[model samples]
Target: MTATPPHQHDVVIMGGGLAGLTLALQLKRRFADIDVVVLERRAHPVPHAAHKVGESSVEIGAHYFDTVLGLRPHMHGAQLRKFGFRFFFSEGRRDIDQVTEVGASRYLSVPSYQIDRGIFENYLGEEAARNGVRFVDSAMVRSLELAEDAHQPHRIEWSQEGKTHTVHARWLVDACGRAGMLKRKLGLAQANAHDCNAVWFRIGDRITIDDWSDDPAWRARCEPRARWLSTNHLVGAGYWVWLIPLASGSHSVGIVADPRLHPLDTMDTFDKAMQWFQTWQPRLYDELDGKRHLLQDFAFFRNFSYGCKQVFSGKRWALTGEAGLFLDPFYSPGSDFIAVGNTYITDLIAHDRAGHALEARAQLYDQIYHSFYESTLALYTDQYPLFGDPEVLPVKVIWDYTYYWGVLSQIFFQQRLTDMAVLGSLREELQDCQRLNFAVQDFLRAWSGVSRRRNRPVMLDQAALPWFAELNRSLNDRLDDEAFKARMRASAERLRALAMEILERARHDNPTLAAGELGTLLAEKPARLRSDAPSEAMLFEPG
Candidate 1:
């Protein structure tokens, strides 16, 4: 008698968390007739707010979720709209209002959100199933047999309810996050130079920053008095504390620090974290002193930032999300990278469906994706020392956002991530911007070394900068080909000018400031420099 044949599908996604489920939804939307199955380890209806740590979204991730996936209604309805990133240099102080504050006075044109991962994932599961994706929760992937030939289908075996099942698929994806099912199996794991540790927890009650201060002027700095809505960062020498509001009425708090200055052993537990906070951040300690019982969860990770050797392959299998690579969470880039990886994988699968050559496309996409990773990695590596330097940090934040919005965000927003010709044309400009960023990060570190670490009382409002605000608003513009190219050229000039300005300011503060390539990079003038160069007012001035 012949045995029963395994079920067949076009795609089989392992570990149906954020990356896998979202990828499933994207594939179904991109190709309605494609057969896709997502195997998830955890059961459905997971608890909200306390489920995960990455609950923040920036521009690229927000656009991917809202516009790309058409989930704006759900996001707007369920998640809290972020006011923008707010930073306070209030280390070891109880009076946060007197600290040098850096943030927008109002919301930026481009929107982001404080996500409740559990809430969003549950919705995604339902949505994917509704759209014909076979989302099997509480299903554990037992084994995988990747096909060597492009013509053959990969086989996957999973167990659900103590019953084993097998399926064959043309494409396989490992979105298992840090579990890295395929990455481990293929020896694709790699470590990064950044050796920072992180500890995060969620409190059942809302911990509002707005209520921390009673001063009228401080409360009125942000329009509508919604500072609580922002992703607030409390920065110090080797660490930063984050306070993010969740839609489920819980507050997420975290401490991310370089182990050299702040060892993980110090704040690895609830009681220890409170003691550490008392010495480093007295105001936060005071708030949580009596509310220890409101704590819903606690977790920590050593050296959270990592790199994957290879995420995409011509062998019909790919890894997305934490299963692949992860950069720093300072800018909340976890979801942004997720969006990027998912897009690349979807494009590769599309190539396979069209009977096109997968080897070349896979190689090119891998290069471009890793290039992006390295570019972003420069922002965090060896930069924690400057977290407490109020003067330099405000300047660094402006430059960082400029680079993000001007270059990388443009490629993504214009749907040009996979456009080889456009990318080829802008390669020089992108490289210049990247080189400048490296120099700038080094430049900032050097600047901080000589910094006075000024803790002023003024609020450095980003929205007040007209050109800066305009650059952010440009994300919404749907530009034609010529317009997009022109925009990129303008962005290149904008970044060059900003870099020159930052270098000049650093030198102005300390004549012996050391920065490599900044002077030479700013010297080369292919395009005319903008007449409206960034001024000293862009930075926080010494009183």
Candidate 2:
């Protein structure tokens, strides 16, 4: 090992990926005079080819970067600016399609953006440097030295340029994505043991966004098209393709499949993956149309899980981003989660610097953070069938209503408070929904009963209204029953109208909203949700 470096820092962050870099920037911003060092295994500004995956962001996540961290100005030059997500569920044009806007305003509430991951990370690195964080490239952290006292400072050993060095820090952060070097070294790493592995790459020239009309409202609001293609066709197994637009008119596309449905071993090399993509993703295959260039090489991973039980060990160590939790990317929450984690870490660091007792706060953060992932796991693992079922359509519709209300609530009411409370509430809701899980599962098993036999595509009708009304009544009790039903009717009408509006907006290429504009919608009370109602009360009941 090379000789130890002579200097020490207040914090040493491992891995220079999104989470690492964001925390580095946030820490320096909050504590300007503290010495912060970032160790990255790759050389400066890691060269990553543009890819189709890792393109979408959720509203809650975007708010942190744009408003909380104040990185919006820097992100203005990103390849794509997305208003919300547009989901399509089949290979050909005849599949189920839905669009959900993610922001706060009824007129201007689109929630997130899409961008090239490589470019975005590069921008973060530069921003971190500007904020006074020292980023050391080509240095891989091999192991950590726990302070002999176990409560004192810790030492980090890393290698670069064929030399080994040790550095001491009052605090350490692990932002290492996927590799989990620090996590493994600390013996905090654990397998998810549930999710399947996925492989992805980007194909350029074969894809284009011109076929997708720009929304004038979206254009005015600076919203870019972030398209995702899911599958209900082509053998009907679980797999998806995504086509996201970037700044330079380039597109990113990739496939995510269930290992049991589509094993990667069948496609061992980049060529095999491409061939599979051509066979499965017709639009992408047609777009490629003989193109020979690849923006990214093949990348794969096995079934992933979340939660690093010990994200922060005492006063001097913490984990952020993927190092802390690796939720399934079905929601496209990568950057958002990283940004949120960084914000929390910065808050803790600030508290420590102020000499307050932070152990309680740290523990609270871990639980809340764990709750977020746990809630996510529940949704993806247990509730995912809602997306593919018809008999459970009413439940899915109600859930969507709940989801939108929850998003609005967070932005308007919960923003000023701790996230733990919000997540804690959600955890309760998930537990309450556990009984409903079997109902949803049964619906999935008999999906063909309603879906396949239809002579014409069936859209949800007024029959779903009562269930939604009951749900609304159960969740909030301030409004009278009649008034609550009216509100549900209104919200449902609005959703239907919004669907048409989205189609028109897409056709005309218009952008309708801006960041931070959704506060208006939240100002109005949603359909009266009753505190004493079964669903609402069940959600808050003792677990």
Candidate 3:
């Protein structure tokens, strides 16, 4: 930035948290000789397992750690293998399983983890250093000087131990979480419609969901019955409470809500959060009442989901993780995006170092990346109002997961992320899913408006649902290109049929309900769905 700095590395990454550390390790692993430096603001040995909020991983992020990054050994030894997601729609009930619950009876075929952020980050830092990547701790980045010319290197200035330092690099990456250092410096911040708020705390010991109920039938629903290992959700109007177990025997509890309905000020403190829980989720509140003295930490954030104007650029700079864009944490996608964005950044640097033109690829990546972000955003934005609708919310969950596993997840698992021709061919299908998502979200809102909350006591076992279970197992299929496309096409048709089923159920429940956008989507005759595909029976089946 100032002509040139005295000392330089091939790449300089800011914010040595999860994203930065992972990227550093990835770069060194891919291009062994490439010089990389990671600057972290906090000193190491931050804490044990309860360091950060996001500890759970879904499929894509889990795959990034296990298959792509080759961290399977550590994953099995140090982290907890996640039981599939569980949701309890017991708004005011003390008996949890007696209420309408949706979850799997057995583990899914694929793998994910309940990560202890501190433990994972510590391991990543050590691995990065061991693999010849320079990891600097307690280092604060002051400024980023992105070169106007694509061919020029970027310059970064940082402060460490009361001393200022400057370094130049061919590539600069920002992985700072919410700080968004470079994002704010360049005025790249943009707002989304999902103005959600969150409050989370770590308990000193595990708050086992299983211990809350003593009904033998409820406990026997699972095969290897251990409900506490799952990322359990206690849902109500406009909010959901997450209870995740850490490897250190502590539990991570969070309450994320639509700010308008459940104000952040209402639950900003431990006591306040307890009161809110007691009002909405009495079962969870009763469970935590005895453990109040063992509370570890509490924090809150308003409007956590956001967008960035530009993440990747031909200007030799890129943004990753929370420094770029953040979708709602409803599904824990932060690490998945880190895996994806980090891969793209390293790929760009690799191309540049090999003397290849990367401008076109960067542009394409940006378009596709933002497209993915926007598509996922549709799942959470303005959808929180339906969180407590026991009938519609369950249906919404099925459809949301179908779209996720079928479209985006297939691309990731098939290792076809950068495959433009494939993405182009599936353009119509992806667009349909996005449009369908918007329509369904609207329909749920309308459905919730006219419908009543049937907080009935019953376990809606997800594993017993044939098509749902099939989709979960299908993730492991080793498909050729032909079969993959066929599968995707089948998935799209299934979604179409699923939409029809959802619309029909809503109409049956609310005779006076206006179909709105959902009616319009169903008006257009979809292509004939497969005979064996899911039907209305599959969607409306009893547990």
The candidate maximizing TM-score is 1
lDDT of 2 at 133: 86
Q: What TM-score would every model get versus the actual structure?
A: 0.97, 0.71, 0.96
Off by over 4 Å in 3: 1-5, 525-527
lDDT (10s digit) by residue, model 3, range 377-464: 9888888988988888888888888888887788888877877787778888878878887898788888888777776677777777
For model 1, give the 10-residue run with minimal summed lDDT: 532-541
Q: For model 3, how big is the CA root-mean-square deviation?
A: 2.2
Better of 1 and 3 by lDDT: 1
Q: Candidate 2 on 274-388: residue-level lDDT in tens?
A: 6775665444455564665645456766665555767865466788877777776666766656765676677777777787777788888676556455544544553333333
User: Residue 150 CA error for candidate 3 (Å)?
Assistant: 2.8
lDDT of 1: 0.89
Each prediction's Cα RMSD? 1.8, 10.7, 2.2
Top candidate by lDDT: 1
Model 3 error, position 62 (Å): 0.8
For candidate 3, the lDDT comes to 0.85
Off by over 4 Å in 2: 1-5, 48-53, 92-108, 148-151, 209-236, 267-270, 274-279, 382-401, 404-413, 416-543
| Per-candidate local distance difference test | 0.89, 0.53, 0.85
lDDT of 3 at 487: 81
